[model samples]
Target: TMAGTGAGYDLSTTTFSPDGRVFQIEYAMKAVDNSGTCLGLVCKDGVLVAVEKFLLSKMLVEKTNKRIFPVSRHAGMASAGLVTDARQIVQRARDEARVHTENFGEKIAPHVLAERTAGFVHLFTLYGSVRPFGS
Candidate 1:
């Protein structure tokens, strides 16, 4: 699905079961105008969160900055709207996870990490009036 066009935000959920042995699910929420606000959840052995920022056609030509945030230790996060904000959130999540690991020494669960990421998104929404961008 294409989201963040001139159309309003779109939300969708998809599930995949491969050979009936493994179950995977993905949930996505996207904003209007391609301003690039969105969230994605990937569920495999665990859950991974991804966010993206919006990019203007002109900005795409410059190629000065690119999205590079790790969603989990084994995954990455990206978004389509407000690139700076999405980057900031990813950086903060990495720092927070590092600190938590240092203090807990690997006791943290994947679900907890997912929750933390969601909490950050929630806080951002509470403080700002921006939507997510994606498909």
Candidate 2:
């Protein structure tokens, strides 16, 4: 059976609208779309990341904001959404890498780190008490 098409469906993260859209996820995407540009490229030697910062306020100090953050010795992330939210994600990623190294006696692989970070972000959308990151 098809679910009802109503605005109420958007209020719950676990509920999908009649068209199969998750409103919370959509909201997060909108936030990212409105933020600074972030991109990455793979070169012959390594990867390169760049972020175009958007200054929205006059009181903000110039050249003080950092959009790229290191998670491990060899891994880092370039973010485009809210700064505080990005910081939380970076911190969680660092912790994940640290814990993986402690338990396995090696650095966390890039794919493993990505999967762990994605799972961590996904959890926020499952509960009503917390909106999805950057949403």
All-Cα superposition RMSD per candidate:
11.5, 4.6
Worst 10 residues of 1 by lDDT: 21-30
Candidate 2 structure quality by residue, lDDT tens digits, 39-128: 999999999999988777899998767889989898999998888889999999999999999999999999999999999999998897
Which parts of model 2 have CA positions greater than 4 angstroms off?
1-10, 16-21
Score each candidate by Cα lDDT.
0.49, 0.85
Candidate 1 lDDT over residue span 1-135, tens digit each: 432432222222122233331111111232223444445656776755543434456647655455546655754665554466667677767766787789988735657766787787665333224432221
- What's the TM-score of every candidate structure? 0.47, 0.84
Which residue pairs collide in model 2, if any? none
Q: For candidate 2, what is the lDDT?
A: 0.85
TM-score of candidate 1 to 2 decimals: 0.47
Q: lDDT winner among the candidates?
A: 2
